[model samples]
Target: MDEALELGEYLPQSFANLNEQTYLDFLWSALRTNYEAERYEFASLAFHLLYMSFVSFSIWQIRLARPGQFAMAMVGFRSEEEGSLLDCESPFKFYDRLKESQIFRFLKLIGCNNEQVGEFAKFVRRRNKIAHPTGTVFFNDQAAIDEEIASMMKEVRNIEAHMQPVIRELYHRFLRDSADPEEREYTVLGDEITANFVHKNYMSAADIAFCQGFDIDALSGEPLHDAMKDLHDALVALYPAEGDVEEAA
Candidate 1:
């Protein structure tokens, strides 16, 4: 009981304005939003991680094939204390560490075509916006909310179209080159990788597409489509419609 009372001392003075039930309501809302927000954030992260893994693997292969070339090209990424290397493991951090132009140049060196390099930059930028904190509140107007949803779906499709083929080709090439003919998993490597990644990471269809030989169209497939729709509906319900806000006002 004393510990509980001590915890109360840390509560903000502004919270005193709210009744206890209001506090409970706020807690419940936070709980709901936190789950939904995490799911949404992680959905994007699935794609981001898969993309990073592909790039990292390709970079490793480049190092294996031409040790001097990869190192020489990465000189720009080097800092005063650090040598030319992408220190961060995550795609977003790798992107942040290097200038956009530098990243594009490095991608070219590593075998990404001009179009693939541009698409990758765009995809990473979108992922960064999603990952970073933005103080913008949810739209209280229905039309605005609809617009926001449309924007999200468009971004989703953009990521799908641009990154899927690139990732597919990368993994396909990797497996083709790296897999041993005698290994049992050689023939089913794609399916094995897809299953493991999806099970372990709760990866979205987009994440699995590279290994599964699918595309953004998979997003509209049965299980994924229903799951995505449920998440979307839940998120939409969290925001107040224009009429509801006016009524509250």
Candidate 2:
């Protein structure tokens, strides 16, 4: 007999109240449960190991690439091209800009708060190390590795438990709230926004054209200015101001 059958046989009468079909269902369910747990554990271990390797690799890359200069350029801390050395300084400038960005706002709407987004960005950066590397040697530190893996597994489980319901609800709402045509438009718009912003300059002219093919004015048969005003109002309502900060006097 299979281990599952043997295990089922050993169960007490109360535990075995499941019918034959239910027993089969329980067996399959048990297999799936084990598989998911093992898969998560494996992924967690892999991620933790990758993160450790990333820390080492990132340090090396920084030394070789002189990424400090790149970071400085990105944040306008120093202007090597403009013959200026670290003059402009505003710590919150980048944060403020990110707050205003459409992509960031969308992410915020989908329950990924600023702190969570920062952690996700770090995870992506770590993932890049492995992706960009030609080769890597696996280092064994069993105890530490195991602990890191456990922590990662817990974190992943926590995230899934917390976010899965919210995501499901959002998906259900989208399906219910939108008509077929509106759903198609929303999907196209989402794809376009992702390709335009997330993928940077990777998209071709054809791809750009495909994304921009939808003519909102033509579809709605409304003036462009009126459509824009409506869009602005919707956005403002979606992401309302936090406090009673008065406008500049």
Candidate 3:
């Protein structure tokens, strides 16, 4: 938005009477929302939803960005010849069954080591406890709440560490491998990846937590890489740079 305002200054004639102050704070609305947990159970449940959504979104992206080999392999048919008509079933029947699936095996296949896989699994049991009904009583236990949040973040790190590199490598290959004839299909691949992350919401705050599961920094690298330059050119066309943001006097 700030980027648009700055550019709009130079293009005043493009839109009659548009000014920097015209749509100044239109990025978000005036309504404010706040949630406070006075009960331990409520806090636990709230955190559970936040943490789960983050992880789930990440997994969804992985499924979308997967290469052909690993994509169909998650269906448990990667090793067998064609015979079963039920082969079209989704590998993830539901998000709840993620822990029971061959997710760890898939992680290893995608180049993540056992430790990274194990670290991500460390919180599933705890998450399950809060996600389902149990005879356990609830109290305002600060220490336990702290521990759960810490563990959830630990799992977040494992996902970023183990999963992102896989996407990066595949994204790079997509840019280079499909370019024997022209300037390359980097834009095509970039759009495929970006469209996966495209969000239309105009809100802020907790939305950042939802970014954990997807092809975020996967297509990125130090500015030194030629692929990074190509990817930047593709992305900058879509999202204008903040460096261009400046108020016109």
Model number with the top TM-score: 3
lDDT of 1 by residue, 5-40 (tens): 221211211211235326434443443453345443
The C-alpha local distance difference test score for the whole of candidate 1 amounts to 0.41
Cα lDDT for residue 124, model 1? Answer: 65
Give model 2's TM-score versus the native structure. 0.25
Which of candidates 1 and 3 reaches a greater lDDT? 3
* TM-score versus the correct structure, for each prediction: 0.35, 0.25, 0.49
Residue 25 alpha-carbon offset, candidate 2, angstroms: 22
lDDT of 2 at 94: 28
Instruction: Identify the leading candidate in terms of lDDT.
Output: 3
- Report the lDDT of model 2 for residue 24: 39
Stretches > 4 Å off in candidate 1: 1-85, 95-138, 181-204, 210-249
**Candidate 3 accuracy as lDDT:** 0.42
Total backbone clashes of candidate 1, pairs 3 or more residues apart or in separate chains:
0
Stretches of candidate 2 off by over 4 Å are 1-107, 131-138, 164-249
lDDT, candidates in the order shown = 0.41, 0.33, 0.42
